[model samples]
Target: MKKIVISISDEQYEKMDAHIKKGSALNLNNETFSGYGLILNNAEGGFSWLEVDMYTNLDLGDVNWSIEES
Candidate 1:
């Protein structure tokens, strides 16, 4: 699997947190982890899903993720 290190803003994090909690309350085990959840990538934006397992670690290399605030 491709290692995608997404850089999201604090606001985005809060939104995601709430969504995950709601999923848990609804017995959505496939959509929530201990606390973190999965944000899928799709053509038109994506939805939430549970993170099953990480395939690999990301190597930032020369790319800076700090500037990607969204």
Candidate 2:
């Protein structure tokens, strides 16, 4: 499988954090997860080719994921 790397800026993370804190009183929904959740969702969509390959019965390897800090 191809690799997808997602990176968010410090400012972006802070904004996400603030949004989460502000909504802490409410139930979480899509809007509450538009940060990394949306990013990972889009990445999965971008990697939909793997699913397409499975539709054709291709012997694709297992999906793998990991987080790294730099």
Candidate 3:
């Protein structure tokens, strides 16, 4: 597999941090894999979404997947 890095802002980082914690608590953290998803804008600037699961692994390099928000 290939590794690529993507940049996110600080506010997004915080949100993702909270999300992962909640997800792990619920056993819904998808960190055995990494995927890409999209948020779509709707009429009146609303939001819609889509996601794709692209990969899976038993380990995620040197970091713990759930808390590595950045």
Candidate 4:
């Protein structure tokens, strides 16, 4: 198993903050998780993804995912 992190720009962070303030829930879907789940694979100790209240539809042009250094 590997650790990963998502990086976002200040502007995007602000946008997300504002969206949350307005009670807009994060729009997550297949595009965000690729239909993967953590609970389903937890017993096997495999790779999977789980997110809560995070948006999937955004410019995300500068967003990036990277392995977390141990």
TM-score of each: 0.39, 0.33, 0.35, 0.41
Per-residue lDDT tens digits for candidate 2, residues 12-60, read 5565555555454343543343222332322444442121111122222
lDDT of 2 at 65: 39
lDDT of 3 at 41: 23
> Residue 40 of candidate 3: its Cα lDDT?
24
Score residue 21 of candidate 2 by CA lDDT. Answer: 53
Candidate 2 lDDT score at position 61: 25
**Candidate number with greatest lDDT:** 4
Candidate 4's residue-wise lDDT over 1-70, tens digit each?
A: 6676766668766765665543343224232333212111122334333232433432324445557765
Q: Give the TM-score of candidate 4.
A: 0.41
Report per-prediction Cα RMSD to one decimal: 11.6, 13.2, 12.8, 11.0
**Cα error of candidate 1 at position 18, Å:** 0.3
What is the per-residue lDDT of model 1 for residues 1-70, given as tens digits with 9 covering 90 to 100?
Answer: 3455556556555655565556556555465344333534333334322222122222222221222323
How well does candidate 2 match the true structure in TM-score terms?
0.33
Candidate 1: stretches off by over 4 Å: 28-70
Clashing pairs in 4: none
Candidate 3: where is the Cα deviation over 4 Å?
Answer: 1-3, 28-70
